[model samples]
Target: MNIDHNDEAIVIVGSGAGGGTLAYELTKRGLPVVVIEAGGYLRNEDYVNDEWEAFNQMAWLDPRTTSGSWRIARDFPNLPAWIVKAVGGTTTHWSGATPRFKAHEFAARSTYGRVDGANLLDWPLTLAELEPYYDKAEIAMGSTHTHGRKPLPANNNYKVFANGAERVGYKHYSTGPYATNAEEYDGRPASIQDGFNFQGDKNKSKWSTLVREIPRAEATGLLDLRPDSQVVQITHDPTGRADAVLYLDKDGNLQRQAAKLVAVAANSIETPRLLLMSGSPMFPNGLANSSGQVGRNYMRHTTGSVYARFDQPVRMYRGETMAGVIADESRHDPDRGFAGGYYLETISLGPAFLASFAAPGAWGREFTEIMEAYSRTAGLWIVGEDMPQESNRVTLNTSVTDKNGLPVPNVHFDDHPNDTAMRDHGYRQAEVLYEAVGSTGSHRTPPYPATHNLGTSRMSARPEDGVVDKWGRTHDVPNLFISDGSVFTTGAAANPTLTIVALAIRQAEYIADELRVGGI
Candidate 1:
């Protein structure tokens, strides 16, 4: 199967937040767009009520050709990192905790100086530059949280941190903004706020880019979605410009999609892998690898969870994955000896079967007893900021191949000393919050394995420092663009979906403008 040269469609790979939003935005403006998603399309009915099933849905079942297994951290083996491959990508199973990156987050280098062994730099685009896009994304995705309108939510855990911050005379505010709908907008339902029981009932109002953008994009005849099409490589022209992508359809047929512009929306880990696989004479390192920054500067939002069992059941199961969050601490303070901020929030507890594995104590009668005791316990998560390091990188492991006979992403990452210190500080603060809430047996998960991956192809002003420019266009390959977490220069403490959507929306405008002008 081959797409004709005259198709007049922009080909987008990976239909997650970035690709999905791009497809919607472009098609709405009457640009023909072809979206290729490795994962099949799934509907709300496809979501199972069971925690294990829900967790499993977070990944692509086909191990080969997909990065499903590549997300796991090899060094520390027990933890499971979640990423999705379906048309919605990871947004389907995402915790739906959407918070905007702070204004200072975009200028970490200038604000806090610099850190050793880190590539902290000011984004080419400032918060004010992206603010309009953020608002556009919020409107497009039906974001829910109140921005600077009222004080942040005051759960028992956040109250403790707020009081401490107040006593210390530090400026603290609510987690600024969220993409989940605060009220019904754009025909999407309102966000329902229950306690910690996310598995209790499904909230249809929660806006996932899949549910929000894909449908809108599909309604336009300009957009066509091809699910289960695994892209193998990008085809580049002699000048090192990507002109098309080569992929395999579900029937194992080779297909080449030619587009004047190509956007790689695969997430941080896979985006770089795709580029590296697309080798050419003009780009021996890889397509768009003139600076050798294709797969560098890897980062993930390092997270730590503090668990506590209350005497009275706090209704541990209730609403979304993260219903309420404490944003007062989401800022970097060099005086505190750390360059990271943390967003603290409550998390869902798995059902009995999965809870058995998380339960403390040895795998004997003691473990069983512990499981019984904490079955209804509530937990808090400290999603902390991570500084992007060039060394903590993603490279293709030729020795390892998944089911698709493709090399898996070999991720090499270790927490920087300051990162570890920030995590420790956040853990101590979480312990304090638990104690303040009158909970016993509060403890942090031992060194969380990286899951929220970002920054593999960081965006900057120049090709020397990053893979993409401020507009998400590759510096080396002018026609090739990236729209995903991979373009982030810094990983904020917040869940990255909202920011990813905002950036994709911003990229869409740039692409639309370039198309209008017939410019590369």
Candidate 2:
């Protein structure tokens, strides 16, 4: 089904949850696709369990500057996004939480009221409209506790965490809704409950595109998965329809892949940066920057962490990285002193990351004491909805260039008052949550480099508001699309991967149907 002729195949950039899922879906439907990824095709067996070793192996450690009022600017000044630059993208490093977005979260603009200094916009599509796709994505990903996928067994960390949740009167605490397999399902084996998997799950229990979609797509024989192909520019014809993608191959040689349609799923930072770098005379600002919103409204979820030291050993790092989540706080209660909400997820950072992130530049007996009590520490991450500020954005810094002499991206973020308030509330709630478990004391870790980068080319109902429409097709260029978190209109409390896959599945259907009808 590799349709031949003058027209190019559908080109999908960045083979992560979104792009990889789209490739499998489209190819399985008899449509040919060419996926170009910037990272190497590291297999499941090639994964390293060591903290720093895995970090070096899979992280997108390119030169990107950070400048903002956020602590990450002062702490991790060189790394803005903690995403991966491989075939599976950040799915390789994700904890596999797959909770769905609440209905109200979709209509943030209408529900959250007009918050000052926030560029809030309701998504072009609703959860009700996407519910079927969400179901499909869950089935495809084998999300635990969904579609009869068994819940992952609770380890000691979750046992401690759940007991605390119960004592604190939080109702929605559980072992899963995660994508990692609890039992043998979909040809993937059950989890081994090893601590080192989060850096990169070698056992293949975690649902990642590299483990699932890419193999299936390749088996279909209609998909071409090219690794180490860093797409730099999206070129267009005179009519402003995306016609081809120019990328640097593995050998650092320039190459161009003609495209019948183009989908940019290059995470949040690189997606907008690529667009800005591809500016043409027709679209001076960027390829799809007609609304001047391509690089604006950047959102990384408001995040923080609380680690507590108990009298006895908790050994939090003995099981899955994020084993339990307390969802009681993930609600719209502005009376709690914030417009949005956050979830308290059980998190475990290996000693290396813990020491580096727990206290960036601290020294003394107190810091040494915290390090010494690593085995007795229990950790919980605060993941919350962050306001999309017009000022928080990803822009190319011409002052700094990459290996290819291209301008490196400069991420600028200033926490909104709402973000600050919500983070503070989350920290307070987390400390209290830990206290419920009879913890001696706790330390709140500042936000690390962003894991859930979102909304750099957001979806909006109006052309004047964003880069893409409901189906992820760019409003300015009909054939261009955004298939990653970059298309998120508002950053919801839930992790974005499940939604990204769901949206990509829905987008594939839309693109396939449109192609059949000559709409594209």
Per TM-score, the best of the predicted structures is 2
lDDT of 1 by residue, 79-102 (tens): 333577788787776666667888
Instruction: Give the runs in model 1 whose Cα sits over 4 Å from its true position.
Output: 1-3, 61-80, 147-178, 181-183, 191-203, 352-370, 447-451
What overall lDDT goes with each candidate model? Answer: 0.72, 0.91
TM of each candidate vs. truth: 0.89, 0.98
List, residue by residue over 1-520, the lDDT tens digit for candidate 2. Answer: 1222435599999899889999998999999899999999999899887899999999999899999899989999999789898889998889999999999999999999999999999999999999999999999999988887788889878888898888878999998789998888899999998987789998999999999999999999998888988888999999998898888888888887888899998999999999999999999998899899988899999999999899999999988989988888889999988887888899998888898998799889888888999999999899999999989999999999999999999999999999999999988887887899899988999999999999999999999999999999999999999999999999999988999999999999999999999999
Clashes of each: 14, 0
RMSD from true fold, candidate 2: 2.0
Candidate 2 whole-model C-alpha lDDT, 0 to 1: 0.91
Worst 10 residues of 2 by lDDT: 1-10
